[model samples]
Target: MAGMDEAVAELAAEHGDLDALLAGLADDRWLLPTPAEGWDIRDQVSHLADTNDICVDTITGGPRPLNEEALKFPTPEAFTQSGVDKGRAMTPAAVLDWWRTSAARNRDVLLQKDARDRVPWGLGMSAKMMATARMMETWAHAGDVRGALGMEPSATPRLRGIAFLTLRAVPYALSYAKVEQPAGTLRADLTYNGETWPIGPDDADNVITGDALEFCRLGIRRASRAQTSTLKAQGALAEAALDNLRAFL
Candidate 1:
């Protein structure tokens, strides 16, 4: 129910924060390895920029088709391979600049569109969904950067929307991981903005509770289960949920 302007502003602000973080890093820092396999700081930035380009193409109804190519890869392994190949040759500064420009263009398009209008991105999502996806991407990649640099990222209240959306998609993410939870019952309690959003059954033995940002980080697999104090998953359901979890399909 959030408006386009609000969504765009939140996403754009996160983009600016990410840009600042990338810009402040030294060349050597950019070369440091991240949690993402075979990718460093530069690759993470490039991937974010590449994502923006794809979003822009989708939103504008451009000539490019929103197929596997635009979406990049069907699997995380394939996506990482493509990013490694593309990012190996790029300079850090170039990657940073490209992301800045691409994100700005996407922001402009979002600002111009109706919030409810449908945009043909991968998996058929509305303009608001596209914006939310962008926000999720920013948060996920920011985790990659944070992991590499050993820095802690502050939680953004606005990201609660994306986090809630992600919870709804939990079953889908689990399916992608090729893992299934027991039928009985389970609940995930996520806290943000001084409120708790529960996902799953009311009378469930499994419960995953955490700060919203940490929950997002764990869901994306950017932060290892051992690294987060905000997360507490009880029973086998919690463990099953963590295996091969990913934000993007």
Candidate 2:
């Protein structure tokens, strides 16, 4: 069984990787725009740190709203926009330092509790669910950082496991994309650790096959569907699925 310790460790390792990457970036590069709409690198890092604070608050307390209105804004986009606007005034070094400190605090909080503790998220989830969501967010934003800096991201089995779990939330993604698949099974052949984990047996006539990372990337729309060499999909469900891809619930 996956324990809290394992999740915490994975979170910490990914946080460390983020820290190292941010630390190496030049100050000017921090202002570079990323694929995430209006966010620059500095804004992205600060947003991540801020998200950690929000997560810590949720885990330690009862329930909290994950959206900006609940956070006193009209939308998450507004909140992130505000963060970016504020972050633009700070130096890149300051942003990276803040992220490091905030991530450490968040890690401490998660490490102190069991994985099953209840925590409130925008979509109604427990602490474990929130943690998994954060893991996915980290990976996605990290991909943004890597892409902006022309850096290649290294994949780990631990990260892949998290991705696998997050990908299971495809129905949520489908809802967000406003795309639905026909009643049928879709087989996903995922390769990791010299083995394969078949993710689905949906009754749809579609199948999506690829390396774990590539599949995760495509499912999240982080990597263009055309860029994936390992993916093979058949039937109308495959194309429809690609059209409505989303990484978050």
Whose lDDT is greatest here? 1
Per-residue error (Å), model 1, residue 116: 2.5
Using all chains and alpha carbons, the TM-scores for the candidates as numbered come to 0.79, 0.83
For model 1, give the 10-residue run with minimal summed lDDT.
Answer: 63-72
The whole-model lDDT of each prediction reads 0.75, 0.70
Candidate 2 lDDT by residue in tens digits, 94-185: 87777788788777877776677666566666555566667777877887888778876557775565555545666676677667655555
lDDT of 1 by residue, 1-249 (tens): 347888888898888778778876788999898888877888888878876776787777665435545355676667546644566678877777888998999899888888888887655667887788788888788878988989776577765766765665667777876777455455778888898877677888877788777778776666777877877768776666655446665
RMSD for each of the candidates: 3.6, 3.1
- lDDT score for candidate 2 against the true structure: 0.70
What lDDT does model 1 reach? 0.75
